[model samples]
Target chain A: MKLPADVVSKKNGKHTIQPLSDPKIEAKDLDFFYSEKKALSDVTITIPSNRVTGLIGPSGCGKSTFLRCLNRMNDIIPGTRVQGKILLDGQDIYAPDMDVVQLRCRVGMVFQKSNPFPKSIYDNVAYGLRVNGWKDRREIEAKVEQSLRHAAIWEEVKDRLKSSALDLSGGQQQRLCIARALAIQPEVLLMDEPASALDPIATARIEDLIQELKKDYTIVIVTHNMQQAARVSDFTAFFYLGQIIEFDRTEVIFTNPRQQRTEDYVTGRFG
Target chain B: MRLLPKSFKANKRERGIELFLLFCASVSILTTLGIVAVLLFETVDFFREVSIVSFFTDTEWTPLFAQKRFGIWPLLIGTILISGIAMLVALPAGLLSSLYLSEYAPDRVRRVVKPVLEILAGIPTVVYGYFALLFVTPLLQKFLPGLSGFNALSPGIVMGIMILPLVSSLSEDAMQAVPRSLREGAYALGSTNLQVSFRIVIPAAFSGITASFILAVSRAIGETMIVAIAAGQQPRLTANPLVPIETMTAYIVQVSMGDTPVGTLEYKTIFVVGMMLFLSTLVLNVLSQRLRARFREVYR
Candidate 1:
């Protein structure tokens, strides 16, 4: 768990690169395209292990798109193309021999709208394990219970394991989705504005769960609220248009960013 | 009547228009009631001559013979046999086409294929009957030398092809209406295309698919022209689809074409058979509606 040495930069306007404590994922010189239109350009960043990293920007700034690139979720969208390297533990995920399904098993995602399967609460949590070829019924039940407990929703839904997930309230549904993602025991969890559709109370609960989840899973969250980013993230990256304006510790990004655009965005000058 | 308060006031013209719309809505209901009344009145007269027990239990259906026999089973069995053959052809073709159209086919391919499939439904059923008599029957006779000139097999296959669009189109709509988020959710769990389409998408849309299947079967039961033209007018109780047999609708058409007296027992038989067909379809439609309501609570 040693921090990598800082790489000195010659660019005067950009912030100097800082060292990271054991980077778990890295994107280098990445370029993304949706058909003919360019969406992201030469983006590069390191995601540290056992920490929550927040990506903050206004609408259509490619924050969610960037999050999806980590696990190749963007590949599902037709005619979209990617040109860059995304590495997980020194192995390139986009390599020709790499198995995308295996990569997705190791890295799970929660959508912004909390898309739970229209199944029972128990089955929803056990879906990943079943799909990955788990056959033992006892083991599946145990893992489902453990994942639900980990997501902090087991107590509320323990009595209704066989009930449809849709019967639960909105916050419970989002938690059930998190439990489903966790059931696969993924090492990395990607959250795409997981609280945007929830109420203030539900949003607070999700924030707390995110803080608890970082101890076991490397978390990367995309959000529109700068205050929420500061509240939940250890590291913050500010994106503008199609590039990262600044990437640094959460405290530095909020209080004293080197880039003028980062300052304008953080200080509420303009989105 | 007392004058209403300002907030509760109703405009006279608006009330008139509302009453007119209500009347328009009741027209179909009134027509259905009128049909039921006529069927009941004729069915009572029919039972007076042909005993109710003999109509259901007797196996022979020769009402025009010197020694008359009245059994409904022969006609009912014929109807079931033709419909069964039609379903055997229609179900797999319809389901596979819908799965491909919804899950596997690209947008350009769907655009080119869907309308072409629906054209089968738009073609007149009488034209389908002619096709059975002219093309499909001859093709079958070549393979099976024992095939009859006018057998249930030809009309059954033709009717199956005719209803392909109904089954495929309805099933495809049901599958397509499944939210994209569910597909994404399955993919996020590392499922392949086949797994997502079959395990997640199909199960989620099962109610709608079942309803469409039942509706298609009802349509097959009600088809007349194709069976009448190709299937010979001989009421037999056999299950062999290769033989010529008259379905209930075909029998109705057969009697209607002749110059039988309006109120005779020969003419009253049509009403009784028609009542049975209507009742079966009504039961099927009600079951389909119930299934549709049960599983929709999951998504909506």
Candidate 2:
């Protein structure tokens, strides 16, 4: 593929036809626990810059748990603990001096269920900017428009910016959530089954959106749908029972996985 | 043969049980209507004797005196003054404590503290009246040398304390009822705990919190014992909290206890005041209900 110039620059010529260099995030021997129960065990994977990396597994397989660990979101849950390291752009995120707030701004999240604030659509997009102290009204307005456009929902919402966000349809709400995350200008986006709640058409729209978004932002998505993982991801990691079973290029993982378990899962033999 | 009989006995029993439940529900509703009816009837009689214009416009409130002035302002102002003070004390304290309970408190701490707070609500209002008179007034007198033994300030503060559980408990419930997903969404945007709380959780729970505030204010306005005992029976039109003043509830208590003969206009003053109290609280309750219904945000 003839890579786009921006993509080449973003990854420092580490585009397709070469091995990934300078990963955006690297998890090394990461272990996680919720109180006494271990959720993720010795999970290590590299998420390359400017690519959609999909984490695929069945329920309770710790794929979602691993996604949350990237931003230290699990910190909010009581009695949860993380062991080992998750480094974002070569710095340890769990270090004592590292601010989790700052880290989250660098890595935004879209939930499985679109959770827009019970506020106006304009205010919902402006929330992240306001919290991050973006004071200029003109700048915020421009950014809000730009973000909504980037998420591909600006045209539908432009006329009724002051309307309650809860009034939007399911697909539009999910896109608004993406715009909300994008407004912060995060370098990475974490999506946990972002389309699992939507219909087939809405899911297709979201999948197309992921493709568009990956050109600018490193995307990490967790989905149970094998075809979704095959369609959207550049790199795919198959997680089973709190561990990564296989990590490879999406095509290889779907077509010719090395591990027997990966093959079994990909072929729908067993999960 | 029919697989199942018609079971007319079971149907009759169900109908009987439903009728019993309906009767139980209607009893409370009927009692409320009966009270309102009596209040309306007596209030009409009171207004017939005392001109409606003078009852509202006149400033003095001495229906018991030889030169009986029938102005309602003095008692209304007194109720306003005490309720204002109580709200000033309760609103911030209740909201902040509710925020703490909902957002900051650990599971163990909440478990211990919630029941302890409800115990404050369960304490008898008569006991609170004495606590205001015997304890809080003396404590205030140390700081406020001009404070009267029977003043509105002490009881107002004590009433605030008494209603604090109501405000905090209800507000905390509202805040806690804010969906966890909303909190997570705010947090995911790099919002600090305070930002997430005030901006997102509070706004989301706005209707419930406002309902709690209105309910608390109504409770404070209708409160009788604390004001009756600790606040003097003087129906003064002044806003001064340090001086003695009588609320509507307190004035009713005073008239009901005094040797004034029933059916007399002086005796009828209690019903008039009771009618005013009933109307104000009824308005507040309806307003709160409207607010709760209108602004409640439903989440899936």
Candidate 3:
């Protein structure tokens, strides 16, 4: 019910990150290819710290690819090649010496479909922490509970931490995924259609959680749902044909856009 | 919807054909049920003549040649020993090969390697038997002294190789069935590739993989000609692999070759042994199905 105070403010069709709100991540001319087929071309963007940004686009528009590029998820995909310079906190993330494991830890991801490990809820939440060498049981349990409370799922699953995560409803499962990501204490969260598989009520709950989480974490999301973007994100980037057509404050992108393509898409004329 | 006579006749004929097909399907289903019924009835009859106690407890199994030491344990021990050895050789080698194919192999190499593996599956057990007897047994003799020419070790190893495809192919299917999202989830959480495969992917596909292993076990158990030729038809009670031991199926093979007289208990022993093999495998198969269902995907 309460939105965080850290949401970035808007002007005309652009978002100006305050000097104190210096961007945590910046992409400069990021280009991607899947074999011969181009996915993203000459795309550049900045993500301000402690704010939620949403990437809105039609199918095949490469929003998910861009999100994956943030954490090098695209590296696992075969025939995927990228040419670009991406920086995290002023350091080039694509540098030869970059450690992907540490990069992934600094930048966590939740997928469109909730993928809780086929483990107990307690084990699922403890997975990331234990893998990272968190040996103290009391500390791990506290962190997991803190994360679940942050994701707005503590009340629902508190009584059943030892139950199989697969027993949870889809909405609860997605929230649990968010909790799992938070347990890692990632500086940024990349969500790819995180609520596309959920019902309206679940979607709304996720949107509220995103709004609440903006105070502590920088979040990037890709969504086909126009209303979700406007509701959850402070800034929105409209991508079309592997290019960011418009990057601006979410209200401006939805209510009034500079590009006719962005306008038509937000107005629901076509993808 | 106008009921044109020509179209009406076509629709009526289609319905008639569908009904006839259903009847044929039902008849085939009844035939299967009938075979099971007959097999069970004959096995029960064979057991009626021999007490279940002697059939399981006694050590000797000389159904013919007048001495008639009619114990079933030698046959069972032989079957278990060979099958156990075959599974031991097959399970890890097959699973690791599949892991290489699915996870580690380059695309071009996989394209070449998979079919080569399938060729192993297609080779007849008889050819494998000859290869084991003539080739592998000679190879084994260098290390194991006084190894019987017809021994369980060579045949079991060859049968294990023969069933590798069964394990690898089925495991590959199950492993591939695991969605990319699951692996990505693990990776996104900073787990290594080894961690992903061992911790998540394997567990995610646990049901399918376990079923595959079970199927390979069943295949190793039922394999006859390989053991019949390479493994002698000596029903030994010892657990040693260097000596000749006859599996239940190999004993059945010996009886079917017309060495045992018709209508004698020597002949009836085949049915009894067959029933034991069938029932044991049936129980194994049921356990596999239950494990398969227990670990079935619930995330979706």
Q: Which candidate is the best by TM-score?
A: 2
Deviation from native of the Cα of residue B256 in model 3, angstroms: 1.5
Select the stronger candidate by DockQ from 2 and 3. Answer: 2
Per prediction, the TM-score for chain B is 0.94, 0.95, 0.92
lDDT of 1 by residue, B1-300 (tens): 366654346576678889999999999999999999998889999999989999999987876667878899989999888888889888889988999999989778999999999988989999999999999999999999888988989999889898888889988988987898888888888888888888888889999889888988999999999999999999888888778899999999988888878988888988998998999999998988787776565567
- Taking chain A of model 1 alone, its TM-score versus the true chain A equals 0.93
Ranking by DockQ: 2, 3, 1
TM-score of 2: 0.95
Error of 1 at B69 (Å): 1.9
Output the better candidate (1/3) by lDDT: 1
Q: What tens digits encode model 3's per-residue C-alpha lDDT throughout B83-173?
A: 8888988899989988888777878888999999999988988999999999999999999988989898999899899999888998887
Q: In model 1, where do residues sit more than 4 Å from their true spots?
A: A1-21, B1-26, B293-298
| Reference-based TM-score of each model | 0.91, 0.95, 0.90
In Å, what is the interface RMSD of model 2? 0.5
A1-271: candidate 2 lDDT, tens digit per residue: 1111222222565654654565899899999999999999998888889899999988899999999998888988889999999989899999999999999999999999999998999999999999999999999999999999999999999999999999999999999999999999999999999999999999999999999999899999999999999999988999999999888888888999888999999999987
**Per-prediction share of native contacts kept:** 0.54, 0.80, 0.70
**Model 3 Cα shift for residue B170 (angstroms):** 1.1
Query: For all candidates, what are the clash counts?
Result: 0, 0, 1
